[model samples]
Target: MSNAATLAGGFPDLSKLPVARQAHWMRWFTAAAIVAVLLAIGRAFANGQIEWSYVSRFLTAPVILQGIVNTMVMAVLAMALGIFLGIVVAIMRLSPNPVLKSVALGYTWLFRGTPLILQLLLWFNIALVFPTIGIPGLWSARAVDIMTPFLSALLGLGINQGAYTSEVMRAGMLSVDAGQYEAAKAIGMGRLRALRRIILPQAMRVVIPPLGNEFIGMVKATSLASVIQYPELLHSAENIYYANSRVIELLIVAGLWYLLVVSILTPLQMLLERRFARGFSQTAR
Candidate 1:
């Protein structure tokens, strides 16, 4: 064989191409696969086996509006409480006191270790364990009734979410350099002041993206409260479907609404992330 032919056989061809050209081919192949799958799904939908009217009607229902409101309410409330508790736990975990650190670690481990569903159920039935919770001389009611399923759901979701959030916060804290902490201390900042003013602001930039994801997850997680009859989005959908016998249609409506909420939030999240990322850019410069 000629030297040119021998070299071609030895090198296999793509040695002449730039890395970017190779990447382009890889992306093209991925896009083609994605397009093929989408087309297949579209074909299935086009077969006319699904009832579109039910989905439309379900979407238009006032109950769905209420459910959406309820879902958002629960998600926001849970996230707020979770973030607050997370801050406390994260601080405690990072504290020098061994007792505080151990307690924080135990709390995180216990909650994160258990299933969220079980926690919700336990909260729902917590009143069962303590028939009444009140001042010794104060009036009291059945624990179960006092802590309604909704209240239980909120507490359960919020506390469990806090456990996870604490870890996220802790990770963010650890991402900050020790030099920053030392610098804050050198500037005559107290421990709490350093944490609040210097550390947290920086840590939050790292935390917000994951926090946004956690919020999105919480939206879905709120649906689990439906199991205990909390009447959030999924439960509301289930209620309507049961009455109308349009299970699949109602579910599709619920799914669409969830998608819509997530879509709206995604841009907001990206915007916040970008805003936070500005500091990193400035610091790099």
Candidate 2:
């Protein structure tokens, strides 16, 4: 029975045996239970009191198509405005002068502190305060006429987005090496030129991921414009439901469209991230 004695006697050794594989029965049981619950949920939805036919009918309707087009248009325009303001505010925040820094800080605080919907409403009703807005005597127009639902939504969304984007941009700028800034100065380059040519270019690798996520969030946030009568996707869906009273069905259709848009943006974001991270190692990315 002694393995050493048996080995000494020219018998086969048993101490060098292979390790036994574990079955992990509990893990298998947990996974199976989760799958069973998911199946039950799917079955419930399949038999739910929803009119799928209406969803299909309005899925490609002309109004729905136009709504989606408007949604994309606003998203792009608002994001462009946001990016521009963000860069300016970020630079101001980083500037050496006290006035510029304080102004930038105040702008960020005012916008980021309030509700976006409230801002939209304020812009929409700005005529109540200003009445007729113009260059004193040169020209005059009703504030209500100039600040339509489209313009109100644009100003509110774009300005609010700038407040948040400014922080993102500042963080990206700070991530760049101080040595790089000094190097730019060593060549007699000014702060703006250094940032434009050197610092910002390097910081982009770190900035793109978060910026892409924010853009995706902007796409979803466009739905909030519906409250102001902007004819984006959710507004159009609500119009159909308001007429026929198929509330859940129309909501489901909107949800599906939102999901589709977000899904497409996710892959595109990944592509942008990869493009910016080209020089970095896999682990760094």
Candidate 3:
């Protein structure tokens, strides 16, 4: 019976209706199968192979804590460096001078075109290419000594980050209304002052979301610094596992700590996004 007829005949209309979207049953079956597979994974994880004891034991160990601190420091410092350079690059890219614009484009192209790991390795082994680093006329320091693991890693990761960040900043700045720039200029404001006081305030709303994601990514990306022998969290985990052969356990410990750090940052990112968005919303209204 047609559904319309069944509804119209208000007398004992308890009959089952035919499916409107026939493919829905297959979707339900697929979802059920996926749930079963996930359950199987959970059972495997619950098995004895994963040593939870070591995870608990070494999670708060002093060395692990130190590694966590170093990772945090690198992420913050690298992001700060990236933001500083990125702002300059973005402004240069937007400037009237063709030279500044070309230079900014070249900088972004060179860094972003290459692999990040390769950059890190190059910075670490810069001594092989340039034995000494510093001014041409002034006294110089040995490249290997001056470009320590920490410094090299920062230069590699942070500078690369700037290239990406510059694009983000440029996009955000462009998202700001052109009329706002004109309005600011109409008030006799200099270009820098206009951006600082007017355009940037609005542009930040668009910038915040992507910038937050980048910061969160940076926290984990700091693990790459380990390759340069910088003792961030993952490197410390590697050192522990190397000595005792509890590879999976130490890995789990590191994973948990990484999750914890990301958890802490997630709320802060949300808070900042909301703070920036609040003004935009009010202005829109």
Candidate 4:
């Protein structure tokens, strides 16, 4: 059974034979089952008691439009406030000063520990605790007047988001190599100056993905503010359903809008990730 003798005898070459593809019966079956389930659900929705007409009508309603606009406005402002506070808090968390570090730790613990809805409710009802606020001699206003639903929602969402974003920022800063800090110091940069110029820029790449996700979450979290009468998308939908009693249709309209917003944000997030990840390896990106 020598190879040379077998070749001379004109036997077929085993290496050149076509390889047989294995059948993935289980995979095919699973995929088919999933499709069947999805179709069944789709059929149920189509034939359900839901009024498609109401969904279509309210989809472009003035109140619904306003609600979506408010939702976006709050999302942007809250995220901006969160980012600013997060940066400051993260820096303090890493500070040598015990006071600063403890304050930062306490802030994170307090906000992150509380349920978001509780925080919203507390902010909405803050007037009960403090009847008035402002500089005592110069300006004073009723707490209820100052802490309107919009302001309450903003403070609740932004401050809560800051606690979470601080951790994200701290993690990004920690991910930078120790040598980078040493290098900055070697070049005679102050800690804050080095952080502003060298560290933060580099850390942006690490933090952007999570930040985008957090922003998307913020958009959805605005719905929670509805309980406090903040007039976000869900609130608008609720109003419609209350007046017309078309609960499912109004909810479907609201759900569609949320989906649309998230769908748009997802691609934008990917773009931002790509932008920040420009110099990174393909796998890392």
lDDT of each: 0.90, 0.92, 0.91, 0.95
Q: List the residue pairs that clash in candidate 2.
A: none
Best by lDDT: 4
Q: Which sequence of candidate numbers ranks them by TM-score, best first?
A: 4, 3, 2, 1
Tell me how far the alpha carbon of residue 80 in candidate 1 is from the true structure, in angstroms, after superposition: 0.5
RMSD of each: 5.2, 4.5, 4.9, 4.0
lDDT (10s digit) by residue, model 2, range 1-285: 666876766667877999899999999999999999999988887899887898899889899888888898999889989988999999999999999999999999999999999999999999999999899879999998999989999999999999999999999999998999999999999999999999888888888888999999999999999999999999999999899999988888888888999999999998888888888758645
Task: TM-score for candidate 3, please give it.
Answer: 0.89
- In lDDT terms, how accurate is model 3? 0.91
TM-score for candidate 1: 0.85
For each of the candidates, give the backbone clash count: 0, 0, 0, 0
lDDT of 1: 0.90
Ranking of candidates on lDDT, top first: 4, 2, 3, 1
lDDT of 4 by residue, 1-285 (tens): 755566846665676678999999999999999999999999999999988988889999999999999999999999999999999999999999999999999999999999999999999999999999999899999999999999999999999999999999999999989899999999999999999998898899999999999999999999999999999999999998999999999999999999999999999999998998888768756
TM-score for all models, in order of appearance: 0.85, 0.88, 0.89, 0.90
| Candidate 1 runs further than 4 Å off | 1-37, 282-285
What is candidate 1's CA lDDT for residue 130?
Answer: 89
Kindly indicate the candidate among 2 and 4 with the higher lDDT: 4
By summed lDDT, the worst window of 10 consecutive residues in model 4 runs over 2-11
